[model samples]
Target: MIPSLDWLLEQADRKLKKEMDPDVIAITRAVITELAAEGLPVGVAQAFRTKQEQDALYAIGRTRPGKIVTYAKGGASNHNFGVAVDVFVYADGGKRAEFLAPPDPRLKQIVAAMKRYHMQWGGDWGSFPDYPHFQLYDAVNGQPKPLLGPRYPGRPLFAGAERMDRTLIRLIQKRLRLPLTGQFDWKLTQFIEQFQRQHRLAADGVVGPVTWRHLFGFQR
Candidate 1:
C-alpha cells in the first residue's frame, strides 16, 4: 500500500520542479527496455509512498515496513530518493493472471542491461541481495574537489590512493634527490617506505599525504 512514485510524478512538475537525476533515470529506462526485449513487461514501482498508504499500513499494525523488507537504512533508501528502481516479472501467457518468478529470465536480462550501463545491481549486496533492484550508486570521492567536512568522524578510510600515489612519488623524488631512474618501478617504493617510517606514518609504502609531507617538507 505504499503510495509509490509512479511515472505521473515524472511527467510535469507540479510544484517542486526538481527532476530525478538524469543518469539514474536513463539507466532505469534502459533496463526496462532491455527487460521488455527479453520478454517481461516490467514497469516502475511506487517510489514515494502516499500518506494514505502509510496510514493504512500503520493501521494494519506496521509502523515501518522497511524494517521487514530492507537491510539498508530504511527511509534513507535509494528508492525513496528515486535513484533506485524495482521491477517485477510477469509472464506473457498463463492459465490465470500471474507472475511466476522474481528473477524470471526477463529479470535476468534487466540485470545484464544495468551492468552494461555501468550501474550497480542490487543483487550484489551480500546482506540484502535484492535481485529485482537496480540502482545508481552514489559517487564517493570522484569529484574534482573533495567535499568538505568528514562524512565519518573517525572511520579510517584510505581512498584516492591511486592519484595520491602519483603526486606523492613526485614530491619525494624531488626532495631527497633519489635516483628517479626514469621509473619508480621498485627502488623508489622501498625508499618511500623508509621515508614513511622516518616520518612516523605507517610504513605501508602507499605514499599517502602525510608520507608526502615528511619526504618533502620535514626533510626526512
Candidate 2:
C-alpha cells in the first residue's frame, strides 16, 4: 500500500495547516496525485523549515565546514515560509529513494508535474541547482499564486523543555553523525547536551536558537 498522504503531511510539519499556506498545500496535493497516477510515486522529504534550519543548510560549505547544500539564507528560501517542498522518488517498494538531480531522466516527469500544478522546480535554476526542491510560484511576472509568509519566526523555538519535532531531531542526528532514529530519545538528548556544552552554549537538552546556531550555523 502507498503511504498515507495525511501521515506524510504530519511528518512534514505537526501544524501543517497552521504552518503552510492553503494554496501551496492544494497545489502540492494535486501534483502528488498526478505523479502517483503517472507511476512516479514521490514522497515529500521536506516541506516547512524554520529560519534556523534554512540558515544551517545554507551554512554548509560556507560559514560552516561542509559541502554547500543551499544558496539561500534563512529568510531567502521559499521553504522558510512553507511554500516549498523537497521530494524524493521512491524505489524498491519505497525502501530505496532517488534524489532528482539535474539531467536525471526522471526530472522531465517531475518538472512536468510541477508545471501542471503551477509550481516551480529548483532544478531549472541556472545557478545553485537544487534537484529535489519545488515551490509554489510567487505572484510575479504573471504567476498566479502569492508568496506565503514565514511560519517559524527567527527566535528560540524551544526552551526549558524537550522537543518533539521529529524532523528537527532527525536533522540534528544527521549533522552529529548519529543514527537517524528520528526520535529525541535519551541518547539524542545526551548528544545535544554535549554539543551544547562544547559549543559554549547552555548545556540544556532543549534545542533553542543557540543550539541551532551551533548545530546549523557553523562547524565545530
Candidate 3:
C-alpha cells in the first residue's frame, strides 16, 4: 500500500527533530509543507550530522571504497552545526528515496521553495553541485556563515587553542559585541569569562555546553 503524504511528513519530522537546530527545523518543515501542498513528495533525508559521522562520509572515494559524496570534512559543513539538511523525493509509492541530480524539472520547484525560506541549495554550487542539500545562509563578505545559533562544539574553547572553528568564534564575538576577528584570543577569553560571571556561571574563560547555552540564550 502507498503511504500517505501525512505519514511521509510525520516520518520526516521525526528525523528532523532528532538533532537539527530549532530554526532550521521550522524552515525545513515549512518548505516541505509548501511543496507538499503542490503535490510534491519531498522529505528530509539527513540533518544535523555529528563530526565523526561527517568524517566517515568524507572518507568516501578517498579512504573508503565509494564515490566522493561530500567536500566538507568534520566541523566544516553546515550539517555539523545543525543548519543544513538534505532532502529527497519520494518514489515507488513513497517506499524509496530518489536523490535527483540537476537538469531534472522538479528541481526548480524544490529550489524555489528552499529559496522562499532563505536557504541556499547545494545544487546551485558552482563546483560541487549537490542537488540533495539545502542549508541556511548568512554570508559575510561573500563567505558562507551559519544562520542559526551554533550547536556546542562538543568541547570547551579557550585561549591558546591550536585551531578553532571560525564560525563559532565569530558568533561568540558578535554576541559579546567584540571585534569579529574569528579567533580565540585572550581578549575574547576575558569577555567570555566576564559574561559567565555576570550570568552566575563559572568564570574559567572556557566555552563549554553550559556557558554556550547562556551565551546563546538556550534554555537547555
Task: State every prediction's TM-score relative to the real structure.
Answer: 0.42, 0.56, 0.61
lDDT of 2 by residue, 89-183 (tens): 87766666678676676778888767645577877889877788887764223345643322222344332334455666678789789999887
In terms of TM-score, how similar is model 2 to the real structure?
0.56
- Candidate 1 per-residue C-alpha lDDT over 74-103 given as tens digits, one digit per residue, 9 for 90 to 100: 334555454555655433431122322354
lDDT of 3 by residue, 149-202 (tens): 456787788887757788889999999999999989889988998999898988
Clashes of 3: 0
Cα-based lDDT for every prediction: 0.47, 0.67, 0.79
How close to the true structure is residue 102 of candidate 2, measured as C-alpha lDDT? Answer: 62
Model 1 worst lDDT run, 10 consecutive residues: 148-157
In terms of lDDT, the poorest run of 10 residues in model 2 is 146-155
Task: State, as a TM-score between 0 and 1, how close model 3 is to the true structure.
Answer: 0.61
Runs in model 3 lying further than 4 Å from the true structure: 138-220
Q: Which has the better lDDT: candidate 2, or candidate 3?
A: 3
Clashing pairs in 1: 3-49, 3-50, 4-46, 4-47, 5-46, 5-47, 5-48
- Candidate number achieving the greatest lDDT relative to the actual structure: 3
